[model samples]
Target: MELEDMPLEKKRDGDGEGTSKLVVEAKAEGKQTEGNARLYLTGCLFFTLISLVLMLAVIVLSVKSQTGSKDCPGTGDDGRCWNIFPKIQAQKLDCHQCGDGWLLFENTCFYLSTVRLNWSMSQKNCTAGKGDLAVISSQSVQTFLTGKAKSFFWIGLKHDANQWRWVDNSALGVRYWEDNLSNGDCGLLRGDGPPLKNWMRASCNSKAYFICEKQHTSLLTILWTTFFMYIKFCRIYGGDKKDDAKENLSSQLSVELEGERGKQTEGNARLYRAGCLFLTLICLVLVLAVIFLSVKLQTGSKDCPGSGEAGAGRTSTSLTATCNFDQCQTDFPDIQHQKLHCNQCGDGWLPFEKSCYFLSTMRSTWLMSMIECTTRGGRLAVISSQSVQTFLSGKRIGLFWIGLERPGSQWRWVDNRALGDSYWDDNLSEGDCGLLRGDGPPQKNWMRAPCAHSAYFICEKQA
Candidate 1:
């Protein structure tokens, strides 16, 4: 109650003091907030700087590695380079130079000599140059050498043990002898002649230009380059540890895939072999079944009704027994005689009387024709009768050889029968062998000709 009665100055002073206290407290809170903002900004700047430095380091390392790889040498005129890694370099690297004036073909270097030399001297010169005489194994190689050879050239072929063989003890497969010559022991390439008639035999002492051959190099440098390129590609794609892990995983996956492919291939091969075996077995079974059915049918056909014992013995009798169609028709009334008569002649012969005749359609020498007839258990036709001569003359359309020959001064048959009556067109005793001349009359169809001449002949056998 006493404070309420006091003047407004006292109230004003109290209010002023409370206002000052609130202003001071707000100023302290503002200072604390500003200091916290500065600390947070400084931490953010530090983190960004650290990240930038790490990225710069990675870029510099990558550039250096690229530059070093690009600096590798040996990539000269051919655009090929040697591998830096010793392990990679050891694997089938091809780094050879075919010397000056030498031509490279496939994996071999060839040198055509300009100076002429004997075969022995030329081979010696080739050996001195770390090569050997050119050995032509294929047509393409022969063609190449022929084109290069401006003159006659000595080859690696030589006659040994009565046969042509290569210098390296290999036998010749294809021959290109000119005119089938059997004169010289050494082989030569006649470059001046046509391509087909380029090879000929010559004396070894004859002087001629020659060819030399040696291995060039293997083609494995490309693989080495590919390996290094793969490594560079991995390094650029990802950082060291991560990319290494990725590459390892990729390698493992590739290995697994390759293994799986191999297994699949093996499985397919096994399946193919099994299928072939199964088909073979099925075919064998079918053949056996057909044979068994055929045997059963044959057995059933032979078993006549009410003739069980006799039918069983028919197999032994059929081999030596001659079937008389008249008797068969009387005994078995159901049997047909005409069908039985059709099977009298064996297989491929024309039946006339009791003998079968095979007409001549192939031409051969007289001696060769006789040999063929003898193989078939027959001989040339012996025209002892006029009817037989007429039959042979009527069927022939050209001059055909017979068994008659004049081995001595007299004409005789191949079976040593002397010539009885002469049916010659003239008394011409110039030739030695007899032939059935179809161009003349049938009565005088016999003529003499050389035995070495080729003509068709007839063969006769019993039916």
Candidate 2:
């Protein structure tokens, strides 16, 4: 019977015999299903761990981007990190820096300092930083500051102006102080201790560093303060004068900005014009090139000088060179690199010991003939002209050679044109060559002997 059709107990226990196998078979199947469920739970936990790690990586990247500092502070209103740096606002201007080194009370300012430097150098450094030394105006304010100012300090008081003066060069007034001195060229504090509030003068050279202050009064604040002072129930006296002053200051600021912008605009215009001209010139050149190419195509090659004829002209010209460089090489091969003033050669040949040669041996290839010189240290016998050659040829009782050659071969020489037409004496009539002989009836092959041959071996050397 089919497994599905059979009764459950019969299939599991197989016929009956009191075996009880059906219940054991069912328990085994239940255990297999439980194992599968446990595997699925383990796989889900691993995937969950991977998702958590990826989420953490994204958060760390976001925090780093936000906290990084790139641009410098104090650059226009974009400095949104105002709270992180010291900021002071007065009127329409905003100034942010470290902090004010000087303190102000009532109408006057004061400072207490520690380190000290020389007078001139200290003034320079402070000016560079846009501040100056302390100037004590009133006796009470001075006394309070100096009492707290323990160490020696410099002040803006000086007698170098031909008389005593404060930082701004105004004469010291006795109205604000209990006492005053004409030549008080130095600065110090009064002896009032608990808040010893007074100013005194000591030596300026004594080492000290003092405080300085710069103040800017807001237009709004000034207006309110003035209004409160002159209040006749808001009658407001002198408001017109204050407004006129404010307007003047604003106008001056605008003028300065306009001047700066005018210069910048003019510079930009010049740069733009230069760029436009450069591009226009480039376009013009390209158009001209196209026109030139069209003209060449329409004309014959010989007329345009650009078709295949250009190459033929080069080869033809090279072959047609009758004499190199416009001169008859047979007569003046060594004439180049010469003084243009040299209209002609010097008088008769520049005769050495026994032969005639050109006065221009200085231009000859001395290196080419070094191996072919004679025992007496003579070289390829140079002849200034046919007359000199004839004399050398006829006078040689023994055969001597001159620099003459056949159509091809070593530059073997013969005793002038008068030597026997048979140039059989030369080693090979085919390579760069030369010859040497002594004064005598024509002899042959003697030219190939080492020019180093002893002087006694030849007629010229026999002497």
Candidate 3:
């Protein structure tokens, strides 16, 4: 009777305890699976967000590469793009082809003759080449010719009928004539003398080397130079590292997803599938990024404006436009600003310091010259210092009406600034307007002249 009772009690205890233990194990397993799915979902979302951020970074870098590093204003319809980028047009090699033994400078080709010839013969030779003898139109041209001149060189200048004239019949606006004005009518450039006063008159029959110039063909080029620069930058800044990091992260995620799939129950299998979908989405994003970059790399716009090309005339309308002309200049100063020419100051102008100067070919009265400068959005040049005076004197061969004027008793600039440093040739209280005598010493070149006197003038404006 005792043995029978013991067996019954043991059976009841095993049934109750074993059932409770099975229920607890099942609940624990379910909780673990839910936690793993939540973790995998969080990881997928995090990686997706990271991929999105990386894609955006690529887009931003590509845009920055398209435009220059410096932001400029006054280029867009809303006044937010850089005027400098458009100005940095790359000339196509095919468009500007200088003959062998000729040097390309700006839009013109220069050739220094090996044989010596008289002024008349030199002019004839240049005409034969469809050009003319060297015309010192600006200080830059003068400098260039001076650098190339080994000895005396006959230029396109002759003192005819008391006035110096170029081969093209244009009166000499800027001159580099030496102090000693000889009786010779032809112009000779002295390579050994000071650059400012290298020109000396000589007989037309005197033998000397010559220079020839001609206009270049039209500008034709695509703006792929900037795009290539961007490609170079990406190559330098670890493009491979970025790809490797992306690949490594994606591979790690794939391995983890596979492990999750192997360990998960049927319910958690959905989570594994979702992770695979997320991975596909990431790959799609990567593919899209590649496509976007490829398209951007291939589609660079033409930079040459007024070339009659459809894309060349339109300005950049990106969202990064925000700077004005003045602001753009102030933000990014050019490294070789002093070397720049018409590109900085425009045609028929010279850049000096922060100013652009225009020496007029047409002569007019002092008042009329002032009016001409005003109409051209400039004013008569103001000689404020010795350097400026020297530069002005070195640039011309004849008298020019400056901004100086006597309004009442005191001499003042056209801008109403009181005369500080005077460079008067004589203290004669005779005329109201001032004339800058280019042939005289820079320190004592200013002379009072009649306001009604006709002469060439220098116009000044901020560059």
Worst 10 residues of 2 by lDDT: 454-463
lDDT (Cα atoms) of all candidates against the true structure: 0.57, 0.37, 0.64
lDDT (10s digit) by residue, model 3, range 319-367: 4345545554444333123322113455687767667788998999986
RMSD of 1: 33.1
Q: Evaluated with lDDT, which candidate comes out highest?
A: 3
RMSD in angstroms, all models? 33.1, 46.4, 23.6
TM per candidate comes to 0.30, 0.24, 0.31
TM-score of 2: 0.24
Runs of candidate 1 exceeding 4 Å displacement:
1-348, 375-377, 420-422, 426-429, 439-442
User: How many clashes show up per model?
Assistant: 0, 13, 4
The lDDT, on a scale of 0 to 1, for candidate 1 is 0.57
Candidate 2: regions farther than 4 A off: 1-100, 107-109, 175-184, 190-203, 216-463
Q: Over 4 Å off in model 3, which ranges? A: 1-334, 338-342, 427-429
Question: Clashing residue pairs in candidate 3, if any?
Answer: 73-323, 73-324, 80-321, 80-322
